[model samples]
Target chain A: MFDLSTPQRQSKKVIALYAFKSLRGFIFFFVFAAFGMRGFLEGLAFTGLVLFVAATSLIGPVIQYLFFKFHIEQDEFILNKGWLFKEKKAVPLERIQSVNLEQNLLQRILKVYSVQIETAGSKEKELEIKALDESAALSLKQALLDISNQREEQEKTEVTEPEKKTVNPTSNEVSSTLLKLSFLDLFKVGMTQNHLRSGGVAIGLVVGSYFKFQDVIKQFFGDYLDGWEWENLMSFASLGMLFSFLLIFLVFSIVVSLITVFSNYYGFKAVVYQSHLELSMGLIKRQEIRVPIEKIQSLEFRTNPLRQWLGYSTAYIYQAQSDANKASKVSIPACKKEHIKILQETAFKDSVVDATIDIPCNGFSYMRLASYIMLATLIPTLVPLAYFGDYNWVVPMLIPAVVIVFWSYMYGSNSGIVTDKGFIGFKKGWLFKSFSISPVFKAQAVEKWDSIFIRRREEMHVKFHTASGSNGLRYFKKDAVNHLLNYINNTVIKSNRNWM
Target chain B: MTNEQILTHSLPDIESFSFEKHPKRFLNKKLIANTLYMIPLAIAVGFLFYNFSEFPWLGWSGLGLWAFILLFSLFVNYKEYFVRGYTLREHDITYRKGWIFHHQITVPFNRIQHTEINHGPIDRLFNLCELEIYTAGGSSSDLSISGLDPKDAQNLKSFVAGKTSTHV
Candidate 1:
């Protein structure tokens, strides 16, 4: 059933997105070619032959404009249409946690933006509204603010209408704070992020696969090798392997550098609206990411070794938006260090806290880290050696195992948590650090855990869980972790404000 | 902090939970509780009843287990009704379970989302009900407060709700 689409707008600009439009058609054409069902495309071809219609008109853009329709609602944003069925949802403003706006090269050319409203759940309750001119999209943010203000009024009234102290609810708006990343800030971010490792891994896989495929050709198509001693070539295979490894590591690092330079430096701009923070960047596939002021679990200005040396810092926010298996990582494609603290202070404008949280790691972290990392190397060696008795993969694996052990040491050494006047920060990881955060009142569950192993060593793990995210300190001296946990727990409990 | 200062600074005074609201014979002695645990032996008895003609030995063992369980339950119930006592701290609600394990969980009032008081058919006959508390992070962390009086359970619900992050 299709309901009528109702939209509120600051202006009359809508984005018609063909997210996978060309790909969808291409796939359908190729897949249907097996059964000789290329009717529509062939028909178009035949008509082209008959009419000789060359560049008569470009109707693709005209046709796409007719396919999509969306508009903002009072408390939510709405989209209506269906090649099959139209679905409409009443997303209350209070339920929405964040709104992200993205723009690509095409959108930038059109001077438009795509807005996404993320609600509180796993169901992807995001209303991805695209094709709005930048100014129209900017003004649309006011609608979101208006609704959030209404939700606050409702909460206050739901508690005690008669006890209302404020006469005007709408007058007090959450002031917006904007953070911008500079070239050096972005450069430092590129260096500190896991972007390099992943790029290296991808290069390895591609080169490794290319070599393996060529080797397969030599085996099955020996004549193609042209009397090249194919049968006795197993010994010299290590040359190919070594060369591939070097190529991956080198090419990957270069690519990583290029990506970092391009992504962070292109067109980065972060703006603070009344209730939301929006960031837009990307030279090619431009993107805009937004965060609600309330859902921001932790925000910080971080300086890694390289960044510290360069005298620049990166700003990031660690929000809770993931399953327990995969916590939401910080996003700082690139930014100057000064912007991070500015974002933190300005994001919570009226909050009383003017402090920070500190994280400390003990020697046990190294032990814990090593044990987890060893699994990567140990399992492959033992399994293949036991089952297939193959030394090819096992010998190659030790290199990765050694590298992992070194990285684990770095990770364990760097992890720490800090608590200052009103703010608390828990920093963990070395290669890619994740600093989880919270206002003191958000601690949902506090526990001091000591295992049989830890008890003997006089060590402990203290954790404080929050609604969407958790901030924890592990492998600390038992008393210190306990005191911190107790203090935070008591601090959260004593506050009259409710945290959800 | 001084005692008086601590009192003023601590969390809200969430009271109203009392022992009079728990089920009769809620707690039990160690030996009697262990013996009463044999009630699940009735499942084995049911298996025996169906094949009693084929396995007469199993039928006899099942009956012996059932008799032991019934007598032990009566003894256990007597001790539990008289021996156990519980206390509620100002900000937290504590539940003490077992004669042997002797462990207690103190749940702070603000952290509790909602409490559900449910009674099984058999529990109804024994005037026993279980109060289940659900917290925010999914389903697994739910706390079950077993063996509480129905009336006190209602009062505890309101008292805890007053301190909850959400009103309803």
Candidate 2:
């Protein structure tokens, strides 16, 4: 649902940069261009691909720069824009939540910023103007803020209009509003990320990048890579095996960890306003998101297995009304490192401890099948070993199988619980970084899932449903789950409170 | 001034909120017809499975699941079929609903941001409408009466939304 308002503008360059960042397909493009061309068919494919990219790249920018136009009338911003179905949005100044400025490196280089005006707080982004005049963006933001302040004053205190202060936004840019983090701050971040999330963030990056680059890798062991070969295949196979063991496997992990370090990079600053908050982040490609104060539904603090080990917890703000589902609208995604503590100290200055119940380690060994997924290697390798009778395929499977068994044993051993006298937490994500935290009052529904198998073992999946989202504790110590559930279910029922 | 006399309108005879009334419809026939048009396609799917699905297990399973699902939906709706009463209190509006799982939701007039009167083809057939009261909380905490006569629904919405004037 779009607001029928004043001005409308054209295509955004930031979106183009984001679309191009899908590095997976870009790797394939190089492969397709380098050697896989089939002369005439190749020429046709290349020509079509070039034309398609050109048209798409041109359409977004053209619509943003030319067709979109917006202007402010007496009390609202009127936006008009359309490529096919002409749409006009009227966003009343009173309904405006936050007016944010977004400029990526490309936008910054081009000396332009896209403006997003959101009101109903349904995670829709509600993009208003792209490639806007920076001065216009500033003035419009100030105008909305000024109107909100006036309305709040009138609505809350029942006061008459006070003389409006002419805000010179250009001159006020230097007031400690900008927060920048440097290399020293990275150390604080490093200290907060325990071995788990760091390893998870690392291994996930490595594995993801390695699989992504599989298309580019032609011959790892020359001819010995697929079938049975001897002669110099042994020499090359040894070399390739060494290369994987040393460089591709080990060094790749380091590279992936480094990439994750940049991906989770946060020079995050929430520019707090009277009624709205503007969030700016990104080290390479900067982005600013604005969330209205009223749209925030519920807030939670969670510690991944890593952060918990490091004695740190992260604060996440769950907002209502995204373009689609409300459960997934996380505006203030986890504050980096000690910033969570700072957030709790400042942003949640008047809050009590959320969950008194200690985190529970749900002892579910079956879940480790994902972490130790190399067990499937035997099936693929066995098929080839039986049909082709080649022992070479079996070696690749053995290496992964060993790693999988080790992974399963380690994950299984680490599964344990530390429940408190009051709240309850369930840990489940992966071996790298599991999420576990729960607040008592927030749990809306408690469900016990028992299939025929689970009931035999006297174990069940306990689901704790908060209004927006629910996390299920799978195969927990049934005695503990049942006991806490009984007490919690009773407490919630006894108290006459508005739940639904 | 009574609470329902939100904004003064020409005084029309005020009717006490009742559980009994000839249901007036709020919805256009086009929407209901479009929704009802899907039944044939569902029958066609069952027919296609019965005739063409080479695998007997697949055909039987598909038809069985559809039958079960259709039956379950009917059961839920049958239990929920309700006619609720709505009235204007001194400072608030009260709506009582629920055939099986009953509820009486109350909304203060001052807290109401807007009011809506909606109807579908089924509602139109029975001369009924769904009257909704909106507030800040996105929760279904707002009062919704599903089976009100069209005129009563309009009057309730107009009255609650502060469009009703006593002068009418």
Candidate 3:
């Protein structure tokens, strides 16, 4: 059992890590300056400057390691920190959303883990315990969970009339392994991870970086390009050159994407216990997270055209948490489409796959989408073309105009669906499709808004605000908005169930 | 899926629901407060005009834009006072506001994390208060209804507080 009253300090190895991290910037600056001014300065002065920065950075974390202390009380976790300023903070146990345990390379070598406690509050407020022994962090987490459960049980007993003779059970013996991904499964996911989009991103990055440092690079290659002018750079853009460039980019994007995916999701495992779900994964940096089932706000099943063709879907579990760490989204990526159906049904405690009542948005939504595209892209394109009186720009502008029209037509055909059971789902996007399903009872609020355009066309935008975030249908028929709002509000008023 | 429907209640007519409007004096208070901000802005523009007399078009355009903003805001404030209203139900609260872009937000009692009553300096002058209802969603409150009578705001706050305690 973990004691609450005794304050504890993190592993002493954290001091060295903190010192090295803090001194990195100063070290880089000194090294760069010493090399740049090697002709002017003596070698002794450079070595002395390096020594001074290293010694200065070492002082702060050493003092901090001696002063930082933490302990847990009955319902709150208290942290006393700051070597010079002396600051104390107390976080209530009930407010904690999730406690994450992570281990990086340094932590693995030291045989310790870092703990991050996230609360359902503002983004600025998060508690971190760096470099705790693995066993100690686990025990501390178990103790905090136990205390939270006890408080919840006490609250429940008080709310209900007369306590039962039999004490309520705390833990269960049966634990089911919900899902596990193998190396082969990971390979498939990497192959289908939108390599085309990654290619676009890589091309953009290379172009941007070259332009940003063009002056430095040009000076380095002083006389290498004796007759190569700036205008001649694009003038050499033949069809053969473009094809070879694309081939190289394609290979680069696929290699990078596969490496990134495999490294991040090497050993993923998901298990379902009595009341919570546990997920552990990562290759170089490992993390373990626990989420209470009741805290889930919505389940989003998403897939792009490429992934759909490969017969895989990604499911995201949005829990009631502060949006500080967007990377904390619990996801089971590249699962079979059939597996998604089974998982969705099991999580929602209802049947959702067989529903055949998807209603598409108003047909006029196409006009709205097209106008938006024109205003965002074409209107700005015309500004410079008109100013420079460039007739050549008109042909280039026609290509994007045609592409925009096609994109709008596909996107505007999006739909919003509500089952007879009051489960709401929204289908959005064209190339990168995303589908979100939210239980009506979990919705915190419902909003209906009408702009002048929507009102004139008798359409409205209906938004379902959840604890994690919000999802909505854009420019649907007015009557459908009323029906959906009433259906959702009725579910909340009558269910008498907890939202979180 | 079960054959039984999840929606039990007969749909209420949203348009037919009676809404409680703010006091007419609230409009005057808003207009005064908004126009008062223009005094400093006008003073700064005047200083710029005196110092840079060479750029007559710049000074005149800045002053003209300021005057236009002052009059436009007065009209918008007056119109908003009429359009903004709220309705309290047994299990939920609905706030309807906006003119060009109309919005109606309905939040249930169980979703409300807390409630607060605020009396700003200008609002206190007119003996009015604002009731802000917060949910666990984020930094901003879910609903904020301003220009309410102090006693009414107090009563509503307590009512919401009571419901939140019972539901949560």
- Residue pairs clashing in model 3 are none
Over A305-335, each residue of candidate 2 has an lDDT whose tens digit, in order, gives: 5555555445565443433444334333335
Q: Ranking under TM-score, best-scoring first?
A: 3, 1, 2
- Please list, in the order the candidates appear, how each scores on TM-score for chain B only: 0.56, 0.55, 0.81
lDDT measured at residue A9 in model 2 versus the true structure, 0 to 100: 44
lDDT, model 1, position A425: 66
Instruction: Give me the candidate number with maximum DockQ.
Output: 3
Model 2 / residue A145 / CA error / Å: 2.7
Worst 10 residues of 3 chain A by lDDT: A160-169
Q: What is the lDDT of residue B61 in candidate 3?
A: 91
Q: Candidate 2 docking: what grade?
A: incorrect
**How close to the true structure is residue B161 of candidate 1, measured as C-alpha lDDT?**
72
CAPRI tier for the interface of model 3: acceptable
Candidate achieving the largest TM-score: 3
The estimated TM-scores of all candidates read 0.62, 0.52, 0.85
Query: What's the ranking of the predictions by lDDT, best on top?
Result: 3, 1, 2
